[model samples]
Target: MTGVPASAAGGTGRTVPRGKLGTAAVNQASLWNIANILTMVRLVLVPAFVVLLLQDGGHDPVWRAWAWAAFAVAMITDVFDGHLARAYNLVTDFGKIADPIADKAIMAAGLICLSSLGDLPWWVTGVILFRELGITLMRFWVIRHGVIPASRGGKMKTLAQGTAVGMYVLVLTGPLATFRFWVMTVAVVLTVVTGLDYVRQAVVLRRRGLAAERADAAAKAGQRA
Candidate 1:
């Protein structure tokens, strides 16, 4: 029938494909955007930082100091990537997912390494790690429900932890001998409090389920009408 129409059945079936070369180019550019590249760089540096910290069985103060410096640089990158993503309009799903993962990995590595050195107590590290792990699991469980944006307290907690870690490292360098203990004590308090705050927020969100429920109800109503 009419030469078996070019697109009938399997004859080339060229129906002006949905994706164009230009669209593909845009997607590739987005994938390699500045924010995502920075995140990847952070991820790559984590293992190196860990290696530096663990290389010398905790004896050499010089190695310890350098390790601390590496950790600090990595943490700074953590802050920079987020700020750049937002300011330059380069935020992406990839950044959102990997940024926190990178933070947790670096923190966990530091805590574990320092704990092994007796600079940090096991119980203290245990508490912090437990909170971090617990909250992360809770987030995943409730991810389908709704987004739970970060609180001001959470941000404060991060700042406190970073400051405490830096100070603790400096103490190892023999600079702030007298005040180091006090600094760490304050850091521990902030960490525990912030962790509890996150748990409380998660519980509240679970009880309400307001955002997800509202969206679902709206969709059903539209379908019926």
Candidate 2:
């Protein structure tokens, strides 16, 4: 309701319903917005977070706490940005492009730092990083086609990952250490499973997109002929 911009009819500059804006109009929307600002903040936090995370090899509890706080703040921006984008219909091309980059950067940096400190298994880091980067590439590959909203499994994987990373960053001991291991295991499993599913979905979408393009082309040829 509020904060909704007046929609145009397919870039015609004529007012129209927001939901009925044509593809060209939507694509022409401006890059700067509230959501994108949050995304940019996340990007700025990446190097700072990695620095804090790796300091003193993550052995100093005081510094580790600072790193955890930084990571938490970064993740919080992620949550709010997406929410604000969807709630206010403030989504834009720049937000779509920059948002995932920030997510992957922060998460990958954290995972790598943890592995470097010998806090987590390298194999786990390798697998999750592979999946994260692969899926991100897939998203860009299909950027001209359409977007894939995060699936339920992807959401679960994020929760598992965040929880596990928090545990590792906080350096919980004893019983909690065992619990974190199990949580991370779940995260890894979800990571792999959802990753494979994403690949399957991307393939299907690409095929459909190609088919539609071919059909559209043939239609134009027939009309011209």
Candidate 3:
């Protein structure tokens, strides 16, 4: 793209085989993509997921079913959007911000609503939410230094949390109830542990950044002298 012809030929994706045209096409292309569209759709469903989950307090199986369906679909979108973006080279700055927000918003709505219905413990939901928010904030806090990449533990945490919350949303009875409880316990543990790990990394990164800045400053001072 850096040296592509200015107006050579038509192309399908982000580039069009031309310089200015390709840049313009890519810039315009950011506005619409399968991944971003899915993300936006997920965000739009948060209210529905919340309202339906709360409507019957999850006592009505039908309402719970609908809520669970919505939550599941939204969660699926969360997984797909990232994969789609990366696979298709459709990643955008907007995607980087919106994807995580959409993920947390859906999860938050589910956890809070489920807890409100007494299906989940308020304290448990609170802890998970706190961890998620803290790490997200830490991400922005240290982003100038570097990005904290995703980890396997983080993926497991999301899976467990989603499974537990989905089961609770469905108001599953009998042995499934116990299973949900255990999954949630695991999720809570991972959430806290991974969150602490992120905090520790952030501290290390901030220190490194400060050291680099100071070193550069001292180098400049020595040169001046």
Best by TM-score: 3
Q: What would the per-residue lDDT of candidate 1 be over residues 108-214, giving only the tens digit for each residue?
A: 88788778878788887898788888888989877776667878877777777777766665434355654666676776787788778877887888767866788
TM-score of each: 0.80, 0.80, 0.89
Error of 1 at 157 (Å): 1.0
Better of 1 and 3 by lDDT: 3
Task: Score candidate 3 by lDDT.
Answer: 0.87
Candidate 2: Cα lDDT at 119: 94
Candidate 2's residue-wise lDDT over 1-225, tens digit each? 422344423455556655555554555654567788889989998888877877876688878888888889888888999999999898887887799889888889889989989999999999999999889889889967777779999989998898788789886889999999999999999999999999988998889899999999999999999
Error of 1 at 56 (Å): 3.0
Error of 1 at 225 (Å): 14
CA lDDT of each candidate? 0.75, 0.85, 0.87
Cα distance off (Å), candidate 3, residue 163 = 0.8
Cα error, candidate 2, residue 41 (Å): 2.5
lDDT of 3 by residue, 97-151 (tens): 8999999999999888878777788999999999999898889998898988999
Query: Local error of candidate 2 at 124, Å?
Result: 1.0
Per-residue lDDT for 4 in model 2?
32
By TM-score, rank the candidates, best first.
3, 2, 1
Q: Which has the greatest lDDT?
A: 3
